[model samples]
Target: MAQLGNIENLIAARELLTSSLEKSKHLASAIDKTGRKLEEINQRLPSLEAAIKTLASKCSLSEIGRHIDPTVGPAAAVLNVFDAVHMLEESLSADPCSNLFRYLSIVKQLEEALKFLTDNCGLVIRWLEDAVRFLEGNAVVDDDRYLLNLNKCLRILEELRVTEEHSLLSGGCLCAAYGKLESEFRRILMENSFPLPMASSSVSVGEQACIASLPFPVPVIQKLQAIIEKLTTSNRLEKCISMYVEVRSLNARATLQALDLDYREISLSEFDSVQSVEGYIDQWCKHLEFAVKHVFELEYKLCENVFEKVGSDVWMGCFAKVTVQSGLHDFIKFGNTITKGKKDAIKLLKLLDIFAALNKLRLDFNRLFGGKACVEIQTRTRDLIKKVVNGASEIFWELSVQVELQRQSAPPSDGSVPRLLSFVTDYCNLLLHDNYRPILAQVLEIHRSWDHAKFEEELLSHEVHDIIKAIELNLETWAKTYEDTTLSYLFLMNNHWYLYKNLKGTKLGDLMGDSWLQGHEQYMEYYATLYLRESWGKLPAMLSEEGLILFPGGRAIDHDLVKKRLEVFMDAFDGMYKKQCSWAVSDKSLRGKACQLVVQIIVPAYQKFLQTYMPWVQQEASPSRNTKYSAERLKNMVCSLFQPKLGMYGSNTCTNMMGNINNAAINQLSSTPAAA
Candidate 1:
């Protein structure tokens, strides 16, 4: 069975081998056929590739159709040249060394195509006409769509730049496109409602707010700038600047007119003159600031960034000069308004506003000119700013002097004092409390030379010093004019004391030197002495020999004459007390001392007279009974002179009266020897 199986296996193997050989033969035939076919394909590959490249160069009429206008019937064929050229570019990218000839061939073909289109094809002209019409249509639209056409036109110009025949054509188109762009921009400017919507966060009001809102929208300006940036020539810049100038001039005129009209509405008589002037000045300053800042930040910013960037020197120069001149003109006009009045005091306050504006202008000028291309213009404007500041300072000095002259009119009395003080107080507070340090310093120089090294010891404000001096002088002179010596002294003492106390109370007190206090003290002593002499000096005359006999006489002492003298002394005492009591002496210590002095002089003399004549007074009961001023009555009356409310008193009057009798006698006799 194994042998039989081996024989069968050998037979099967033989059959399998026979089948494998047949299959191998068939596979060899198939391989041979495939190898022959591949060899044939390899043989034709170069020609096939060249034919495919040629077909690729001419295959897409669709793409060509997209680029060329349908109106250009035959010139549409010229679009095929671009395809050929594109194919050559691809070949060149793949292998420049191998495809140099091909590239040259396609370039020659492109030239031939262009020449044919230019010479024989009306379709090329039709295509250009259609493109121009499309550009015109887009330009006419009041929107951003024109930018697309503008970009397309620029591309066309770039594409035609290499071709001499078409280069002039592009130039014409550029001219037309630029004209269209200018006309569109002009239209946009003319039709645009300038003064864009106010920001929701803005706090501006009245015409200022309106003016602030009047600037063109930022996006609009950016768009216009973008369009202008495309233009490269100086002549184009001139045209653009001309349009810009017209628009800016119109806005400026409107702004100025509006400002003037609003200013006219400010009625100086409607409010406190000083306050009103200040308000008007502040408002004017605000407007000026707005105008100046806008000119630099907005208008000039637009010119520099948008127009001047692409502008000619002529246009930029003219624009800058006009802008600066316009600002100066406005400033001059505003300054004229403030200076129109003869009252230089009012003008001084107004100059504060003007100076502030000038300072702001200086800062703004630096900011604006810092980035400027022109240094000469910057330096010139800087000098102009300095001139303005110096002019303003000069005006301020002149006006300050004039104001001082006006203020120095008549010396301030009680009626006129408030006005003077009000001015002084305001100016002083402004100089000290407010941050007007430089102005204060200048004012000090104008008014008086103060030692800055002695700032702490110096008077706080020179203006205040002047006012105080004036008031003090006037008060002293007025006091001197009083005919009554007592009243004059009393007035002087009261006013001077009040002034001294007030000086000590105020901020200005620290500035008053020790010399001032010392001098004031001497004045106080002098006035006190004068008052004592005027009031107390008369008391001794009333208590003369006719009034009271200090020594006793024999039998008849002229008791009726003595009684009449006593009556006269009583009458004098009552009148003097009434007059003096009504008068005011503000210093408490001074008043008390004055009272004591009067008492020392009069009381002791009366006490001595009464004591020397007490026995005589006891004997002469008829004379004493009829007398209104007895020894006790006179003592009570003398005490009441010091205490006006204290009427008649009893035994204590005599005791108290004689209590200080020795000291009073010595003082009275020593002080007033004439009376003794």
Candidate 2:
């Protein structure tokens, strides 16, 4: 009986164990299915979350919070349901079945929430559109309508902040509620409606500065030539080239902005009611044009001096306002908001560079070989340069008309507005290279052995050659695509400058010496001391080493390197003075007291400049102390002969008149202002 019972128990126990193993397999399958479903839900969350953000962005908080439903607002209702469902699910999720049940419920809830935001809350977008439309059409200058309306929309978000049952939802509610407010704030800021006031309040500081608003307007154009000396490394070349292009672009943009505005109206009184500087942007541009241009020019000139290119855009936005000059009649002021983003604006800027180069080319050519060659070349080159200029100038009118006509007309393509700028730039490059190539070749030929090496290095370097080839290959794509004809323009003028320096720095002054020195006493007054003026009245530095040797001047006393033939000259004029003929009148003060030789020549030579510019000297004393004391003592001794304020280097060309004042002012400020 016991054996029978054991066998029966073993069989029953085995069957029970098998049944338990089957149940376990079925449960594992169910769990795997649940995990797959959860995985799908997880994947759906990102898409649904993105949709929520999109909808939220479309609507204002008021639209989301202001529920038309009589029971509760959608935001409030969604919050309540999500919290209640979530809390109950969390509290009951103790076993596997409970966890699965809660997870399924949460997934359903999330789907519903995403649906509400996407489908039902499109009204939010409509509401936002209405708000934007209302503001755009009815925006008034100096009025707070935009701000007040924005704030009203923001206040409605308070509904989203209050939690019906869960305090935890309160923070999230507030974040969701004010999200539109934050978006609107950002939008307003971007539009410059309520400008975030800067902490320093130094916007007006640079408004009075002046700079050339030309893309390639180099205040110190001389410095840029040094970089081409010996570029051995490709990286350095790339860096410098990029810097050069960027600086060139910036200068051109600044200059173009300064030139673009019609300064017919606007004045100092405009700033009073202007809460957003953008409202009175014209005025700001006018005021800051000075400083902006100065900053632009200064940076560029510094880069030029450093023989590097500068393309720093770090402070571009911050100093955007700096480029607008408020108090200018001649130039257009674009307060510092620069626009290099647009391809058209950039094209226009390049045209300006070409224009500036042409002008400089013309001037330098005229100055270098003034009498015959300049006149002859001017006749040839002037027409070509003029055509390019005219073509480029037409772009502004063409682009404006294109934009205006686009609303009614077909969107222009190859032969339309897009390529109109291209036509202009192309023509400019053609004119520059075609007729100007000879000039550039001549310029290259004129340079010494040292210069040939430099030109070869810059133009024929392996990297630059590759760059040039690449640029040529893609030339058709650029609106400004043409051969680098500006090199002709630059090279011609560069040669002219070399010749000009040679001509002006040599015995060319000797020709005029006999006829030019009659009015010498006028300029000689500044040079009674060693202020470095020539006998005919000119700054000693203005003369070349060759010319300085011909006429010894004051202020600079560095001895020339002894020539190899000094012994021959020494033997020739060993006793030429004949000291017995002229008795020495020993007067201690005469060396400094008598009129300086440079003053005599320069004063008379620049009678034209002096006549117009002499009266504007601000400081009565000499910039150098020794000059000042000597001037004062001389003024006392020969008060009748010496004019108090007038002197050489007192006046400058209109093209760059203010730089002189600024340089001296900066010097004084650095040296004396602090002490004072």
Candidate 1 residue lDDT tens string, 1-676: 1222233343333333322224433533443453344345446545644543454356443332234333232322333332332332233233212333333333333334334334323324433444444435434344434334334433433343344254125453224445655665676566653533332334542333433443456666655665565443314666766776777666555545545435534333343323235556666666667666664456555555455455445435545654654443444444544443333233344555555565657677666554444455566554444433443344333423333434334332211122332343334334443444464344434333323332221343454466556556555565655567677776666555544554453445555555675677678678877877877677767656653443566454656565565666667777877766545443455556666677777777766665655566667747555345654564454444332222221112222322322221112111111110
Query: Pairing residues by index, what is the TM-score of model 1?
Result: 0.44
- Residue 482: error of model 1 in Å? 4.4
Deviation in angstroms for 372 in model 2? 53
Error of 2 at 336 (Å): 12
Number of backbone collisions per candidate, in order? Answer: 2, 44
lDDT of 2 by residue, 22-135 (tens): 443443344345334434544554554454355455755444333212112232233333333233333323332223323333333333333333332233333333444443
Model 2, clash count?
A: 44
Model 2 gets an lDDT of: 0.30
* Deviation from native of the Cα of residue 632 in model 2, angstroms: 25
Off by over 4 Å in 2: 1-645, 648-658, 661-676
Residue 399 in candidate 1, Cα distance off native in Å? 11
